[model samples]
Target: MPRTPRTFTVSDSIVVAASPEAVYGQVSRPALTGRWSPENLGATVHGTGGADRETYVGMVFDGHNKRGPARWSTRCTVTAADAGERFAFRVHAIGLRTPRLRGPIA
Candidate 1:
């Protein structure tokens, strides 16, 4: 068998009392995703800047995820960044402990 790229998108929205900037500020951080996301266990940044760095297109991070007892990680690159508007990333690789399977998984 051969691995093939797959498209996966997860998105939801709820009305908030705060401004868009405040909402974006909270969701933009890969480290804080665990709070709102069910499978995400946050992320481990690949370099020195860490996940605390400013959000921008092309920013890379390792997404830590879990389902019941199964655990996995995915390499993601920020594909969209519009402060106070939108933030998105694409999963380019995945693995048990690290992103060793290089290709799109989500």
Candidate 2:
């Protein structure tokens, strides 16, 4: 039989858990995220209450000129998330990023 069509996209996901709101609260904060994520060595929140930006510092990579080998360096802020059910952040060098969501996994 022909392979089933893939309906899911890289931006789609299903979170098997209860209380998405609760989980969002814990993960929304940068400091909290850092505590929960081992890859994140440290995270600091800037700006003021309600409106804040998260600056992250962790192991990252950087590519040099042509024929140059990749170099590892401390990565910096990749995204600035506002207070909400859905938040976004970026990680450099790792060539990957993530989005935090709350209230029912989509």
Write down the RMSD of all candidates, one decimal each.
Answer: 3.3, 12.0
Candidate 2 error regions (>4 Å): 1-14, 49-85, 91-106
Candidate closest to the true structure, highest TM-score: 1
How well is each residue in 1-106 modelled by candidate 1, as lDDT tens digits?
A: 9998665677877789999999999889998898889999998876678878888888889999999999999999999989999999989899999899998587
**Off by more than 4 A, model 1:** 1-10
- In model 1, state the lDDT of residue 77: 92
Name the best candidate (by lDDT): 1
Q: How many backbone clashes does candidate 2 have?
A: 1
| TM-scores for every candidate against the unseen true structure | 0.84, 0.38
Full-model lDDT for every candidate: 0.89, 0.39
Give per-residue lDDT, candidate 1, residue 60: 88
Model 1 clash pairs are: none
Candidate 2 lDDT over 1-106, as tens digits, reads: 8997554324656674757656656655555544655445334334444214332232122211111343222223424333335544443332222222222221
